[model samples]
Target: MSRYSLIRSMFRPARTTPHRCRRDIIMPFPVGRMELIVYAAVVTGLIFAAYHTTLMDYLAYQRDYIAFTTAWPSKPADFKFDMNVFLEHKRNLMEYANLEKSLMQNGTALHELKVAKLYKPLFTDIPKILLDKWVPDIERFEGVEEFLNATNFNGTIAEEFFYLEAPFFQFEHHRMAIMFPTEIKGLLMTIKIGDCYFWSTCHHTELELRDGDMHVLDVLETEDGQWNISRVYYVPAHELLKVRF
Candidate 1:
């Protein structure tokens, strides 16, 4: 009530309680057991799925590795790089065994010479200028009359000059005919190559001898300076006759 008593009461310290002085304790947020189990199961399922997928990919890679490692080193037995005439004769000697034998024994040298002389005309020439030059005296050749009479062929050199691979014993070199057939009746004029002559003895299924199908030949030079036909490819008349001159 008094002014002095009121000032003293305001300045005096107040009594403190034990509950107010105590510190507050912190606790974790509550979660259900089912929710915890579901989260654990989802994480385990993801790990299991990843493991199986990785294992499958690894097994596929192993199979490819084995296949690459176990394969054969070289080409198969039936794989042929070239079709050699001599090799074909040796494989199946039906009728021209004797004729082919002569060339295999003695005609190696002559083959080289003929190939060297006719390389430009036979292999590389488009106009065949060198061929006309080389065979300028074709009319005066020894067997020209007999050949012309036998075949009845009356065409110029540019029309019928084509290299062929005959399957029979016609007069020619290396047991293969270098025949010039000018007539449409397939009259083959067997040229004289040394003592051998190309003659049609027998016709096989493989011998696709058309009127103008050209035989493209490749010559191979051996290690011992020997030259021979290395590869033979047949181009049909439709393709060959398309080339002008």
Candidate 2:
């Protein structure tokens, strides 16, 4: 061989051995059976905790929302006002009246009046017959007590006279106001205040009325689970004839 040919043969690379096929070789299990079981247990415990906590809370909230939406008194037929509900509302009114009386005696009439939800509505709706020849300057007074005092009337006299006559009075007219259980019926109407269910009833009193014939009571449940008088509509017996319903 020539020197160049010999040199080339010597420098030439040797043939590489064929690589083993890794595809055919089996690998050890990535995770043991015990490790897999532990992982599964942890995942299940997390799921159960989530269901009991977050999911339960969500479900409870949904139930409350449904209850609020599906409350009673959607219509006249759906409405109901039994003696129990009426008595509860009456009791609340009496308590409110007593509070008012106590506040007036303490000269905290303005504070009591500020908390009154019915003052504006009642004063605004005072019948023409109840007022004297001149319209009373009610605007100057801060509260019902102030208004009564300004009009030269004491709390007791005002409660007996104006309050009893006023259609929107908070308290029951009589201490033992006779409620006819048989005649008591619930009548639902469009709520003027807002979107909520309320029990309404219009019934003639067994006790004789000095002026009005019947009393219309609207009772609503407060947020604190107490029933209160939402509205009172005193209508004269003669006026009932003019009223379509």
Candidate 3:
């Protein structure tokens, strides 16, 4: 009870209390099992969708790769490669086998003297001028209207034009934007060499001219010397080169 004793006791350190563990108190939200499951499923679905979309894109590109390597050994897949309509058609020609047969056998050439001639008006002035000057077959453009109407283009030049013009992709697989515009330059167009139309990517595909105008060993024969129609016989502009023993 002395003043000195009281001061010494006050100066002494107080006894340390034991540390208590705080329980992890989760906020008492009344979440049912179904709610938790639904939330988890949504998250999982989002992840799956993202992954699936990427996988699909990759698969589509690979499909193009296989087609390129198998069909066009001559044309390498670079930034500057374009496919002709024949090659494009060949991608799914089997589905349209009957139609192709009719087109090839019954309907004359997709581009005849008459079809190319009469169809000149639909074009802009520049194209009209170019077609008028370059396209020798005046009457050939005449029949395209009937042909397209009979076919799927509904009398529009959409289908027939796609056939004649050098290909730049027709929204198959995905979109035209998928391919760089520059990459389209190296496109081997379908050359109207003779009675047959040929897809020609010889610049990149390394197609060698054999005889007069035949590149793939000159298998096709036509009086006009222009390969006009893409037949099953015509080699794809891009294919694997033969290795000599």
Candidate 4:
């Protein structure tokens, strides 16, 4: 063939090289933008979820370095747990009297003063069930015998560690008041003050708003829906201990 014919034939469009549909898996020449976005999102979400789960598991087991923390059940059936449950459990854990120890031991950087608490609601360890069953007369009676009975009298833990404040006041309009008989008196006690308070009862652990600076008069709950005073003292905000009214 002449050079012109050869040049013309070469210039002629050859059959489009069959586009291998699966060859470019990493950066596929996508058919649609929507599909591409969806694929990317799914990949990203999966990666993030895996990393987050690993982080949470490590926190739960190796250290309780989380602000709100709990260990989930192993079995799927028992894992009916969710984010809300975890939040509540964690918040509850934060209310321990010895949580300072846990915080120190965990060493997860949350121990520092710069910890940021976002979107947190005000929750008090206002024991309803545990107190009622354990000591029904704590709030009803007007004497030291009732107060002593309320705190279990063993005094292993002091009155100050037993009570907490919400730390941040809200529109709930609930004044810092102690609802008890007028007969509480002559009780000299130390109070703890801070943002978080640690509480412990027979078995359960919880976080509270007890930095310090309150006498006992702390209410507690029993496992069987009983409410009683874990300790009797006075807080600065509420001084209901006057013998009169």
For candidate 1, report its TM-score: 0.22
The 0-to-1 C-alpha lDDT of every candidate, in the order given, reads 0.35, 0.38, 0.36, 0.35
Q: Which lDDT tens digits does candidate 3 get at residues 118-172? A: 2333323112222212211112223333433433333222432333332222244
* lDDT tens digits, residue span 131-174, model 1: 21211112112333333343333232212332222212233454
Candidate 1, residue 139: the lDDT equals 17
**Local accuracy of candidate 2 as per-residue lDDT tens digits, 6-92:** 999998998887654552365333356897798788889999998899988999999987865565345433323254544454456
lDDT value, candidate 3, whole model: 0.36
In model 1, how large is the Cα lDDT of residue 195?
A: 33
- Write model 4 residue lDDT over 1-245, tens digit each, in one string: 99999999998988878667656775665657898898889889999999999999997865754332232222212112254544454355344424444553476443332122211232234222111111121222233344444445323222221221212222237654333331111121211112111232222222232332122333434444433333321121111112112
Model 3 regions lying over 4 Å from their true place: 1-32, 75-245
**Residue-level error in angstroms, candidate 1, position 6:** 21
Q: Which has the better lDDT: candidate 2, or candidate 3? A: 2
Q: Pick the candidate with the highest lDDT.
A: 2
lDDT of 4: 0.35
Using all chains and alpha carbons, the TM-scores for the candidates as numbered come to 0.22, 0.23, 0.24, 0.24
Predictions: Cα RMSD each: 25.4, 20.3, 21.4, 20.9
